[model samples]
Target: MLIGAEAVDTAVELNAYLARFGYGQGLSIQQLWAEMDRVWAEMGLDNRRPLGSQRIADFYAHPVWVLNGLFADTDPTSVRHRQAIAAFLKDACDDQARLRIADYGGGSGALARQIVDRLPGRSQIDLIEPFPSDFFRRRLGYRSEIRFHDVLSSDGYDVVIAQDVLEHVEQPIALAQRCIDATRQGGLVLFANCFYPCIQCHLPGTFYLRHTFRYVLASPALSYVGAVPGAAHVLIFRKHGEIDVAALVRRDRIARGVGPLLNLLGQFHSQMKTLGRRAGLSE
Candidate 1:
């Protein structure tokens, strides 16, 4: 929804703009959709419905979504998205001679490329995406420093990036814990562009707030850095020593119990607002 510059004077300027952030090269949404249509025709598939109508199952089963760039387009790409990511990267990669970075649920390896470009020294990066497109994989093959993984490794890293991933998962706390566990002591964990509603497979409004992520930061294992809230909020956490597993489990239990009640309340409020608007009693 956050569109960037619609027009550029020259290809050179556009390429430089993209390269400044290590985006490498990518097609416009129009071009991406055109390619998707071709792929759909070739596969003899015809699901032309809007994104909101598409279910989570369809997203995973169809390569058209991931391979043709629909999945890539869902990421927040506004000026705010770039600024937040840049600020986090500056702090996380500062004064590092060598770094190991993990991008959890990294789609198309965009963030991995950014990390490699931003960091000053030798870096090893891993992109953990469960449903990566062969197209994207081949595109990223030239970067020997970046490796793709279907599952997260048990090994620790200096920085872990889980951008816009929590809202999609069934159990956010579990996923957050995995990111924390993979980070070394005093290492940074970036959670940017998260807690936003998406067309497919996002948690309810009750769990899409800054407080919902507090459970992870409250753990003995992590220290809160800061947050920048916008259409997509960015939250940063730093790992301490080993996590207090028992405390984390207890917090998750509480969240699960309270989440549904909060969701119901939110739904009630939304319905009331809609009714009021129809009655011309509210703006």
Candidate 2:
């Protein structure tokens, strides 16, 4: 497994960091997990209701996400995932004299900072987060290698990462296109999407893309580079140039045609697993 000692330590210290942000006041992990649902209920957010773009943007600015983000990033699975991302990045750009990376919807900037330390070449990372937590600004603010951006810059980046970001957006396709658009030709776009309804915040609208994301986002301009080793969720792709609109439309049609069967099988599997547990067949 690809490991970043410093990043792991930083994630381990998130609970202490949260203390400064007015969280972790005798709060347990379970309570912190429930915080997002609690906020959703307080806001009267209906999962069935689709939020407008601005509303979605504003909702993400809430402080509850800081707690959620800290825990999520610190989880063992997430730490490994970031390690995989860093490994792929290193393999792709290690030989280059300079590297430019953009981490879209990157919550804590931990991954970007970790990359800074691991890469030998001079590198710059732009963290595209609309509402960076106070801890993030305070902890990484002095790092000359990492810069925070509320909006993605038009500059062509050598690598663009959007890990677990598309599921929260109203128009994931639009954002996915933007990720592709921002990359330099032959540069990499790394994506780790969770399109399934695994969490309350993952919009139901995106569930259609759960099985179809790769096909839907397929473009002639983007050559499929395969998934990151040991972390299958994170996909690797190399950009060739401007996206072909006709090819995109065709691929979207293909996804729409094929995704429902996969979704149905997935639902059936979940239902059967739930039934099995209820009958005490398995844990």
Candidate 3:
């Protein structure tokens, strides 16, 4: 929603603010919270009406504000986040001279910057973010290897990264399919922050937690690589071939039917694990 010189100025100010915190140095939770508060105050949002009062669509429609509020600092997760994707690309592109990568819902260009900075060889990166910031647009002007798109296309990228995005969408399954379709055979798809209970425009449901991975694994197009589970889970999948639409639909329906039960069991398991850890019964 920010326009003209004000947007540009805010963008510059935000960059400087983040820099002071050692942007990629893996900030502690306390440091992250303090910096987030500082950034919110700097944006003059500290006194503004709470976002809950506004329609979720309108609140998120302001890409600049949403990104600034949620991601002012790259937290400790970023190091492992970047490394996972980088490792996948390195293996996938073995013996190849160049790679094509896409970041679906990549906000503020943080992950893209990390990939380009750490990875070697010539790579063409495309960011498919519907609501990218003015800062990101400006950065695109300077970075020749990266381009921005308002929508996903049949670009057939070698690697597609979608982090902290699925939980916010209305139709996560369809979006997941789109991400899979946009990837080439043997390409990697990195998904993180999938549906879990949290705040800010997250659709109400635990169906995704129970069945999304099952659906992904059932699809003939994809192969499960691994998962890193925590407060926010990270799932990795590899595209093998074209999707089996009929099979996917069938699996989705089945998942929906049994998802609630699975969700309950999953919650119970998580609670038990937490209890065990507290009781010093877990290694």
Candidate No. with top TM-score: 2
Query: What's the ranking of the predictions by TM-score, best on top?
Result: 2, 3, 1
TM-score (all chains, Cα) for each model: 0.66, 0.81, 0.74
Best-matching candidate per lDDT? 2
Q: Which digits, one per residue and each the tens of the lDDT, describe model 2 over residues 54-118?
A: 25554566666776666555566666777877877788787788899999988588688668878
Could you tell which candidate, 2 or 3, scores higher by lDDT? 2
For residues 1-283, write the lDDT of model 1, one tens digit per residue. Answer: 5434543343345345444433423445455446544544554432333334445444543554443233353444543464456456666567777888888877567666665666634678888887765556777899988898988876889888887677766667778788888998889887764453433234453263334457535866688877744324667788888888888878777766765666568779989998988889644
Model 2 residue runs over 4 Å out of place are 1-32, 53-58, 269-283
Residue-level lDDT of model 3, residues 90-196, one tens digit each, is: 66567667779888888577767666765654678898888766556775588787889889887788878788787666566778788889999988887876455
**Model 3: what TM-score?**
0.74
Cα lDDT of model 3 overall?
Answer: 0.66
lDDT for 186 in candidate 1 is 86
User: Between 2 and 3, whose TM-score is larger?
Assistant: 2
Model 3 residue pairs with clashes: none
RMSD of each: 10.0, 7.5, 6.0
Lowest lDDT block of 10, candidate 2: 20-29
Q: How many clashes in each structure? A: 0, 0, 0
